[model samples]
Target: MSNRVDELEGQVAELRAAVNGLTEELVETKDRLRKLEAEAASEAEPPAERETKSDDHVVVVEQEQDDVDVATDSLGSDTASEAEPGEAAVEPEETTENDTNKSTDDIIVA
Candidate 1:
């Protein structure tokens, strides 16, 4: 009877240690979650404020036209040859049954 009691006590001790370890891990996880939520809250702005701030900011981006042409040409797409430097390629409009009924006056020129 004493041997059985000793074995049960050993198992209880192991269980206690496992429960303690799990509790510590859970606490650490909760702390990490709270920190992350706080950081996210600090960084986020209200929608109205964000929109107003975005309107006040102007972003300009510049890239060389030659670099674009080189990348396109390397990809083996015939786009580079279709248009000359400083010119845009004009595509011919396809004539469909619906399009044929539309008058030329209805088309707007840019």
Candidate 2:
């Protein structure tokens, strides 16, 4: 019974070591694969085939405004929820974009 227990423990240790080595190899393989894929993608596309956009162009992604507020709240604000007795409440900036250039005729692909 004692010999059987010792043999089982040794097998377990060997199995664990093998798993660790395989995990490390798997991680290395994934890293290599990503690098190869990125290189292949770059090589496949020619410079002239890519569409370039102007730096001044602003991409306005239309989505639910409520989700934006929730995301911002989750990230937290610079101001403390309740300031020290003597400290003043820090007001966040509220700059609104002028819709002078905004248009409904927007195309994602264009």
| lDDT tens digits by residue: candidate 1, 62-104 | 4466766777778766766666798866899899877776776
- How much lDDT does candidate 1 score? 0.78
The number of residue pairs in model 2 that clash at the backbone is 0
Tell me the whole-model lDDT of each prediction, alpha carbons only: 0.78, 0.73
Cα lDDT tens digits for candidate 2, 5-106 = 999999999999999999999999999999999999888854323344545685444446677787788667534554466876689775445443344335
Return the TM-score for candidate 1, rounded to 2 decimals. Answer: 0.41
Which residue pairs in candidate 2 collide?
Answer: none
TM-score against truth, every candidate: 0.41, 0.41
